[model samples]
Target: MTGESGTTRLPRQRDTTPTAQVRLLVAVGTDKHPFDRLVDWLAQWHAQAADPVRLTVQHGHTPAPGVPGGVPFLGHDALQQAMADADLVVCHGGPATILEARRHGHLPIVVPRDPARGEHVDDHQQLFARRLGAAGLVALCETREALHHALATGLADLSRYAVAADPHAHEARRAAVDRVGQIVEELVDRATRRPPRWRAWARPDRGAKETR
Candidate 1:
């Protein structure tokens, strides 16, 4: 069904059909860069997977996946509703998206954009994804093989990817905001604190006399 702003609403009905068990919501965010690689991987998986899976893609700048449920963007409420209805949440390495999924009781499967592949401006996504992965906050899939494995695993046991929704969601959101801020600050400090070439060049010999 069409939602506000012409966005397609994700199907909320529980289909009793045998193939309707697994519902995936994939959001690649609304970044300027096109994340064609992730969309391509989803298409490849959907085409080849043995089971019938319901896949809804919020593709953003990426080219349409040519699938039935391909929405370019979702409004705030629509996204939240979609996430609530999804059995599995697959998304980019965006921190906000990751946290939002978690708030909805999903341990999201994340694929960080690659700067080497022109998916993003730099490797910050990769860096942040790794950090969160290390903390066991997300399932970080950096390769097609890994993503495939994650999809297969999540489909097999949906409960494995599910988390307990925080009772205090508002407090959780505040904490998430603070956590993201810390991570960004750390990343910025790491990037900016590197000794610059100018610093080395401007350093004068300790024994040298003062300039006239």
Candidate 2:
């Protein structure tokens, strides 16, 4: 099938066929906004690669350049299946997406969205990616040069990037959950407090009715 950009989707072989190549899955998430910068980089990377690389992309709401066999989107189940079958996973810096990639036993190469560039609602993805990168959980890249370097050196040995079980991982998750719970409780309590309906009208001169 042809994508909106006139890119043709690749056909899948029968279930019995043997796979021989390293597969790469690039997920741009399901956000309504476009992330064409990442999509464009993928296209360029595919074009300039010295070796043939198997590439498939989930180009959500973005205008990706035509690839030989690319899909615009994939269902959740299909996405998960692709990640499991992939030798390397590339994605935006979303906490959930990163965790999902890890769940499939691959450390993802992450390019965080910049809110200043209209890639996300805020810079939380950048923040999270930095933290994860510092902790050796994921490879983080903010520029084309860094991305190319990562793919060259890091892709060949994905095992080295795998996030190992450690005290820091457990502590971070536990602390986040507890902090969020406390914030939620505070919001609910504030919302439940009733305010007097006639409080504004209580003042005679300030938005009050004049005596006729």
Candidate 3:
């Protein structure tokens, strides 16, 4: 947009989604919201909820200002702590966010933002979702319909603790314990492959010509 003095002035596109009812917390860490289009649908669903919907969007960086009920456009200091404390957490697929969600026992829904398509960088969220989803830990929503379903359902058992134990690691590969065995084998293999520094020094030097 050209200004009166011939300078360019950017136009802001406001999200027209009505926030009559919703009770969700949004956490996007420096990633464009690809699922942003679901805002209206989510808001509509929120309105149908028996309780009033209150959404708090916490942007980790300086992005465009979103619709009403949005916090500051800048990042916040207590983002993770807030997520840990929130009733329901909606966010991107990052290690920290996932870990926090698991630690707090809150069910988190990850939205992948694509930069190539002007949403986010590479599809890291896709990878995160794939790995976490396989673990039966998180709910990965790719399409808007899935996201709406997640929003309508909100989070499941949002009060649980993950102390890091092999609850499924017992026996058989198909068994829960089998997965634990896999993780243990991986750890042992990693440990045995790399000897201590003293072991490396104790090895005889084969580079020198062997004297008969």
Candidate 4:
């Protein structure tokens, strides 16, 4: 859009399909670290309740909760396909997983790994999940109660997190790409044109050849 001051703005667009169309996919991650807390919580839920949603779980490094048909891990391709078919995704707070869920049109219900509980090396997962939650990108659940509540309520209205295509956002992305390209070009030029700092350290016997 052209602004009053003659500045052009990128148009933003969003389109959403109703949530009633997909199944459910759950994953923690393939990290070596076990997320038994999440796994156990899920297994307990599965065992106790008659969940109507068709659920497929990728338990990852954690021991299977012994859920009758549990899968230890779905390789990348299988996971992607599962996400594509899912209306809701229950997952750990890894940023890549969250983004992948969103790409598949599900606003993931995320339980971030807590390092205090030895779920991760640090609290980055919790921190990142909070940030995304604040942006209305993912539903954040810190405890089993919260996770259960989110799943119960969220599955019914998956459209709530459906991303709408916005032209403004698209334009901003293009602008960001252009800016990054410019910065990369500048860095490459500088690296190529700048004199080698090791020039002074060159062997005199070698005619002071510049070191790479």
Candidate 5:
């Protein structure tokens, strides 16, 4: 498939729809606060979404009571499975989640967690968001306001979020991987270092005792 830029796109894997109960899947949070606020936000967005009903926000973390829209949270395996069935994915900025969502061909909307705001342990998530968004595989929402808008409207085209896996950035990722592989193999092939004691004769007796 060719996109607007005339770049040939990779063949897309077809998504399998399950019982059709869910159309959107959300995998929020990091090592931080467990996506509670994100869940609350989604609930509000869902309440205003119309029928055909827009989407079912399959969450990855539990929401406190009276959160009107989203329901029970799914396990890791379950959420990935749900993404495979989903038409779209909403998530925090995590590479693993972005990879899975792309593998399943679900357009992803990523919201970066701000550590300055106490959203995560650090700012790596912001980096993740920037890279993926720049690549074209996912749409990045830098704030709760942006996230709500992204979800309410549906998956944003942001193909610019992922590079064409067939080529474009292929050489870059592969070269990096190959370099690491070589380094690892070189390390593995190195001779083991012996302790100073081992360098000494295993048996002082191995050497014929110098006749006094």
Candidate 6:
């Protein structure tokens, strides 16, 4: 199929033949902040894995995980193809990536980047991910142990991470996306309306000396 960019896109048909090797795709998105924590977790999991697996990582700004299929970034068509071909999708807490994974028939395993760890500018991803997780959408893994467990479980039974690509499921996901958007907008509006703490201290006193 030809993509919107006029590039030949891979067919969305997944390989159903029985096979021992599992196909895994990991996307950290195009965020400038480095998500080294996720990369480290993946590297450690891959290093000690006993089962046959094919892992592909879109590392983005983070340093490569020294894995076989590590790529700095992927174009739109490439990403779609990767998602279609993957038996399991693991990605960051970005909503777009999560929706895309669902659209491609995968209940993605999500790991939100921590702002305290310098993975993002704020905690928006964490908040969004928590909302989705509570709704039973994406599988949210917040710590190294949780991520390791998710990887192990997914590798053992890839079907648990598969989602139906039907219209109803799509509509549900769309609504969830809209709700998250509204939440973000409200947060931004509140932040803009409130005065910063520094601004409050910058106010001139009634008896303060006037500038020349």
Candidate 3 — worst ten consecutive residues by lDDT sum?
A: 161-170
Q: Which candidate leads the pack in lDDT?
A: 1
lDDT, candidate 6, 56-161, per-residue tens: 8999999989778999999999998898889889999887898889878788999998888999887778877887889999999998899889989987777778
Ranking by lDDT: 1, 6, 2, 4, 5, 3
**How much lDDT does each candidate structure score?**
0.83, 0.71, 0.52, 0.69, 0.58, 0.82
Name the regions of candidate 5 deviating beyond 4 angstroms: 1-22, 29-32, 52-62, 65-73, 155-212
Candidate 5, residues 76-155, lDDT tens digits: the string is: 77675676556667777766666666655655788866776666666666765676578665788876688777765653
lDDT for 133 (candidate 5): 73
Q: RMSD to the native, candidate 2?
A: 12.4
The list of candidate 6 runs beyond 4 A from truth reads: 1-20, 167-179, 187-212
The runs of at least 3 residues in candidate 1 whose Cα sits more than 4 Å from the true structure, single-residue gaps closed, are: 1-19, 198-212
lDDT by residue (45-93, candidate 4, tens digit) is 6666544556788888888766654688887899877877666788998
Put down candidate 1 lDDT per residue, 82-121, tens digits, no spaces.
Answer: 8888889999988888888987778899999998899988
TM-score of 5: 0.57
Superposition-based RMSD of candidate 5 using all C-alpha atoms, in angstroms: 11.5
Error of 5 at 3 (Å): 15
lDDT of 1 at 203: 53
Q: How many pairs collide in each candidate, listed in order?
A: 0, 0, 11, 11, 9, 0
lDDT (10s digit) by residue, model 3, range 45-105: 5556565555677654434234445654333446645654456666666655665554444
Worst 10 residues of 5 by lDDT: 157-166
Best by TM-score: 1
TM-score ranking from best to worst? Answer: 1, 6, 2, 4, 5, 3
Listed in order, each prediction's TM-score against the native is: 0.83, 0.67, 0.53, 0.65, 0.57, 0.78
Worst 10 residues of 1 by lDDT: 3-12
Give me the runs in candidate 4 sitting further than 4 Å from their true place: 1-22, 165-212
Q: After superposition, how far is residue 212 of candidate 3 from its true place, in Å?
A: 47
For model 1 the TM-score comes to 0.83
Q: Residue 103 lDDT in model 2? A: 55
Q: How much is the lDDT of residue 188 in candidate 4?
A: 43
lDDT of 3 at 205: 69
